[model samples]
Target: MHLFRSMATLVSITGASLILVGCGQKSGQQKETITTSTDSELTTVDPSKTTAVGTFNVLNNVDEGLVRLGKDSRVEPGIATSSTVSKDGKTYTFHLRKNAKWSNGDPVTAHDFVYSWRRTLNPKTASQYGYLFSGIKNADKIQNKKAPVSSLGIKANGDYQLTVTLEQRIPYFKLLMGFPVFFPQDSKTVQKYGSQYGTSAKTQVYNGPFTLTQWTGTNLNWTLKKNPTYWDKKHVKLDNVKFNVTKDPSTGLNLFNENKLDMAQLSATQAKQMKNNKDLISRKQSSNYYIALNQKNKVFKNLKIRQAMSMIINRPMLANKVIGGGAINNDSFVSKDLAVSPKDGSDFTQDVTAPTSMGYHPAEAKQLFKQGLQEVGRKSLHFTLLNSDTYDQKQLSEYLQSALEKLPGLHVTLNNIPGRVILSRQADHQFQATVANWFADFSDPITFLNILTSTNPSNISQWKNAEYDRLIDASNNDDGGNAEARWNDMVKAQNLALKDQAIIPLYQSGEKWLVKKSVKGVIYNTAGANYNFKDASVK
Candidate 1:
């Protein structure tokens, strides 16, 4: 998923013993509840419409896909009890659990998945994530509006069986299935509310361990109650999980100290201040923050200007001093330590060297900016830098504004807004430049590279290169099962994007949190959905 906000509050606590907390209510005892803080507000809970990590975090508990990510991100059966793959690795058949049922007591059937998938691929749905269905047969055509949605290669074999056909072998198919966007939706509930489905808590139904409630469309808080009818309800220990939106670190810290919150995300400054606190914890994320220059703007189309912008800023200082919370500088769009060489198991970052033209060089940047202005026939360059209103993003955007203005005759404006607003503006290509980030939807390099492709909906920058597209396409479809060849193709694509300055890689995102010691069994993963609290308990 493309992360428009920092997922700091989505803490990772996995594999811990499930002690009795709120497993069952005794006659007069109070129900155990865990209150947590989120920095960004969710715009929608609809799986097909979600584009933010915060919403995915919520759906990760309230919706169950064919499979679920377990401790360490292992693939575990959820709605599907088991699955089989064809000898060609191009087809998959899933056997759903007979006991699975929605909150409305309707049996979860294979037809639900077929309907959900077709709805997402429907052009009217306008799901930004439709690009993720590339490997599925006829999906590209359907998304392009060149074929009917009924031609999609997914079918319900019967009431409890589903089969999916792919145009090619998708290395991460199972991992992608665990994502919320691929989760099944009850057709009855969706049709019951029509356009209003998933707009509020009452408009949708749940099939996961938790059921969402009290979330009006635009509210700042919501509650996740343990679903009594969930298939795995016996293992759910928490009775209620309360989520509060607290954008200010100070406010969250105050609430945490007051014991009002079981977990609170800390800002970089707050993390430093609470370095010695026993409750403070830090987790690394498989996400990359970068600057996207909209090529649709004539000022950004000049290659030298893009290179000058990349060279003028100091990434190490920005990561360590401006956005620090264990954040590390990144040289490429694809995050470091995400994937490795298929042959020797060396880290992907170890194998790909950053372009020599990409490092900080203020003197060179000034000269390039002067030349670029001449080529573009402009004495001065002016643009706006869009960023989320969160504390960390504000600081990072300010740093960029100050650094970019250092160029002669360059004027930079800061447009700070909520994360949801940033996403909306970027999606419409309504901004000059924006600080954007991508969290890996699956544990693969294609997750990041595909988003930058010319035809991908997520490529808001509008940067395109035929060679780059060819390399990525070959890696996705034409590698012929040669692991080393496929790896090399992707490596070449990453190198090309960096050399062309299509986007400026800033740093690898990390999170700092203050979680109470009693919160247990919240599974965390660097990739995929970051947190799952289905089995979580508060002691």
Candidate 2:
């Protein structure tokens, strides 16, 4: 599940200058286009429907929300020039930038924001990100089909001001505004295109720094042309940004070497080979990669089986040798450096009170697997491991398949599918086991913890623990105002999940990329969309 959300411009590690090859136009002038590659294909540009990082990254560039992420993941003005908060922190009023206009020449008004929020919260829309609107007044009721979408606590105060009411204060509400899911959509365009909206480049309109072009309903490549109509277009320097879907690291590296791409991500093997390359830029992500077993499967229903599965994989070796780069093994679902304890200022992962569940112990794992098989009235176990068709994911899946098969009488098969298909299947609970990634939408442990709640759409595994749910609920509502108490509740919830082996937390992502020195000002966020090209330029 590419379930997400921010960030700063990337600086070179070795201070080496790389060159970006600019495409030449018919006029003989070089176009400032920064060519990049993503391993996954874009599913949709619709903010409401996006679940994959590729979709969110595309939407992040082609759309504008109330606020946009700036350097260091700070909230900066977007369509909204300024905002004011009520003393209770439940009411937020945003003053829209009067000059902002959509690509279609319609003024970007407060009504657009109001309409967008209501549309996403509408049960008929079936937005997976709807869970993110939990604290908004009437949002939960609407999502649960108990209230009408119109009852959502948001209104357009005239044409240039929007007011939002929340049932309770959300600590990361401001950060959420910068996420593509919270961006405003054009009501007229959406209504005109109906369900076809966002299926292709021409079906949607843009109000951000760039306008998408050259994208068919399904294509391997696309372009984001600078939006002349953008309110802040003056600050957007790149004339065009080109993207290609390159699933293989070898292909991406070749593209980079051939000067066809400004940036290319490296595989663990490639990262090792390029360790001394000045262009090698390594980024530690606030994201977690884990294996989620579907509880509906009989073999996985046994506690011992689940624990044994986690124990079988050598996570440290996976992170250090196999995944390599700067990847780190983790025991808890919440990635480190994501949040700090309000009480002691320690990293959230440092205070986990649970026993280590991620350690590799083949002997204990084999014994437990044998017992689990007998308990389940089976002599052998077999299941498919679903994963994305990217090189890195394929490698990880292969490693898991080889490791899990080490358990006696356990046969594992790999089902590598497109990223879009994986998202769809994961949402529908169509797999027995899947490799999933969670990119934090904000700098909070709750972003990772709350997703495992029994009712959350992101909880594809259907893992449920009443105490875990209670702790998460308390953290969000009862102890939300008390920072220390909320932190404690989240800590307990994380430890509970780890102790239960709810999911096999593998590693925190440490992606290495070969970026051209000529590309500058691109904002790279570890947690969310990962890239923002608004201020980016090809020098």
Q: Which candidate leads the pack in lDDT?
A: 1
Scanning candidate 2 in windows of ten residues, the lowest lDDT window is 7-16
| Root-mean-square deviation (CA) per prediction | 3.7, 4.2
Model 2 stretches with alpha carbons more than 4 Å out: 1-30
At residue 479, give the lDDT of candidate 2. Answer: 82
> TM-scores of all models?
0.95, 0.94
Candidate 1, residues 333-397, lDDT tens digits: the string is 77777788889998887777798556889999999999999999999988889877766678888
Please report the TM-score between candidate 2 and the true structure: 0.94
Tell me the deviation in Å of residue 333 in model 1.
0.9
Question: Which segments of candidate 1 are over 4 A away from where they belong?
Answer: 7-30
lDDT of 2 by residue, 266-326 (tens): 7788998999999888776777788889998877878889988998999889998877757
